[model samples]
Target: MDSVPLFALNDCDVMTTNGSKLGTLENITLNPNTGELKFLCVNPSSEESTEFPQMENGQVVVPVDSVETTREYLIVTAP
Candidate 1:
């Protein structure tokens, strides 16, 4: 983490390539001063893995540079 101000997006919609609602951005991890994003986690309504058992439905890391652009929200390419 570079200690940059974390990108704060509220109720920002997130979707997979296939257009699946992957929840919203829990929060963005970035290198503060450097302004480099590191990883992001999903803020699922439920943290219970067994409740929503899906390998894909979970916190996944997004590459720093993969972010195309961030406006009201961020558009990150799925890895």
Candidate 2:
């Protein structure tokens, strides 16, 4: 896997690589042993969110590998 530059995820917006707004990040799931980030739980902004994977609880779930973070957004790679 390629390295993702670390930054604060707090209150970050989620966007697609093509620049579509998904929503704000709600939470993150990680492995305690290896400190590996697994998934990102996000709040869907609108119907535009239907394009990505989501949890049964109605939250958008973005894989960490699909993320590219900036100071403003967690840029999600298109599948």
All models: lDDT? Answer: 0.52, 0.78
Kindly give the stretch of ten consecutive residues in candidate 2 with the minimal lDDT sum.
1-10
In candidate 1 the C-alpha lDDT for residue 1 amounts to 18
- Cand. 1 TM to true fold: 0.50
Model 2's TM-score against the true structure: 0.79
Give the TM-scores of the predictions, in the order they appear.
0.50, 0.79
Mind giving the per-residue lDDT tens digits that candidate 1 earns over 31-59? 88996566666565345442222336466
lDDT by residue (1-79, candidate 2, tens digit) is 2454444666678988788888888888889999988988989888555666888878998888888767567788867
For model 2, the stretches where C-alpha displacement exceeds 4 angstroms are 1-7
| Best-matching candidate per TM-score | 2
Top-lDDT candidate index: 2
Give the least accurate 10-residue stretch of model 1, judged by summed lDDT.
46-55
